[model samples]
Target: MILPIVAYGNPILRKVGHDIDENYPNLDKLIEDMWETMYASNGVGLAAPQVGRDIRLFVMDSAQIFSNMDEKDKEEENYPDAPGIKQVFINAHIIEEHGDDWAYNEGCLSIPKIREDIYRAEEVTLEYLDQNFKKHTRTFNGVTARIILHEYDHIDGKLFIDYLSPLKRKLLKRKLDDISKGNIKVDYKMSFSK
Candidate 1:
């Protein structure tokens, strides 16, 4: 099943997600659906909040980013974590963030047609559980880290647009409003607040 992504201005996106346990209803099914929804929406990551579920869960496949890159570009951009990872995260927490911040043009499925250069740390150490409730603590770098951080924010009630400057956000107010009111076109399914 391809879940409908919650659009910007949805109150669920602004609420901090709660942690879930193994016994959570239909955990496997939900995770599977998330993967299907993410692929259908052509997104690298999707958080539970994005699908209108306030739970500390997200699915990411940074590997897709590298696989889509041209051979020449891949050679030039020798990211250590290139060819990244495809995994599910549950009850995730960032233990630490390392390295200087780098700017990347980031976009969200919920806030379609809006991309912005967001600055984030180059590396991150995270502690999270897998689909089976098995715990793992891992460190990620480069694009992989960025992807994790982006989805992590969603679980914490934060959005990439929140990192923008006040003036920049003001300039995009109209466009943002349009998204909230379903005045935009997106290939995948989305649920608007209004």
Candidate 2:
């Protein structure tokens, strides 16, 4: 099933998600639907908050980014974590962030048509549970790290737009408002706040 993505201005997006355990209802089904929804929406990552669920869960597939890139581009932009990872993250927490900050144009399914350059650490070490409630600690770098960071923010009541400067945010006010009120066109299903 393809769930409607919660739009910007939704209160659920601002609420910190609670951790879920293995016994959470229909955990397997929700994970499956999230993957379907993400692919349908052309998104590399989707958090529970995006689907109106306040839970510390998200799915990411940075491998898609690499597969879509040509060999030349891949060679020039060498990301050691290339051909990235596809996995589910439950009760995720960032243990540490390393390396200098780099800027990347980031966007969210919740805030469609809005992409901004956000500066984030080049690498991140995370502790998270997998689909089967198996615990794992992993470090990610480059685009993969960025993707994880973005989705991780959603669970913590943060948005990529929150990283923007005051002036930049002010400039995007109208577009942001439009998105909240369902005034824009998006190919995938979205539930607007207004």
Candidate 3:
């Protein structure tokens, strides 16, 4: 089941969600659908916020297909190409963060067709639970680093574009304004000052 993804102007995308006490009814199904959506859309990450859900959860799978320097996915990565598996995080919390900053190109499922170079911490240690409510702590770096960073922002009502320079922000202002005007289907009603 492919879930319906919200676009760039919807208000729900901006809301800071609360922790999930339990995997809500249909959560298992939603995870399945989100996995489908992420694969079908060529995205390594997908957030509940992008799908119009205000839950503190998201799914990430980065080893889908890595673009080769020679062609546009014309050849599969050296490995057999893992189609992508669903990783669920319900009511996740980041207990600590320790790392250097680095820049990498990133794209969003919600804001389609737009890619930008973004800087994020090189390493992060997070404590969270899966859909089954099992606790886990994982430290990730590099590409996986990018994956978790993107999804976590959804829970915090922040976007990768928010970390851009003032000049770039000004350049994207018109587009964001267009987003606010309903040109795109994103949810930007955020509240994360707490």
Clashes of each: 0, 0, 11
**Candidate 1, residues 57-109: lDDT per residue as tens digits?**
99999999998999998888769897789999999999999999999999999
- TM-score (C-alpha, index-matched) for candidate 1: 0.99
Compute each candidate's TM-score over C-alphas.
0.99, 0.99, 0.80
Output the TM-score of candidate 2. 0.99
Sum up the clashes in candidate 2. Answer: 0
List, residue by residue over 49-132, the lDDT tens digit for candidate 3: 888789888888765544423454445433222332347877777776667787788878676556799888866778888878
Query: Where does candidate 1 stray beyond 4 Å?
Result: none
Number of the candidate with higher TM-score, 1 or 3: 1
Lowest summed lDDT across 10 adjacent residues in model 3 is found at 185-194
Which 10-residue window of candidate 2 scores lowest in summed lDDT? 74-83
lDDT of 2 by residue, 33-77 (tens): 999999999999999999989999999999999999998998888
Q: Judged by lDDT against the true structure, how good is candidate 2?
A: 0.96
Q: How far is each candidate from the true structure, as Cα RMSD in Å?
A: 0.6, 0.6, 5.6
Cα deviation in Å at residue 134, candidate 2? 0.6
User: In candidate 1, which residue pairs clash?
Assistant: none
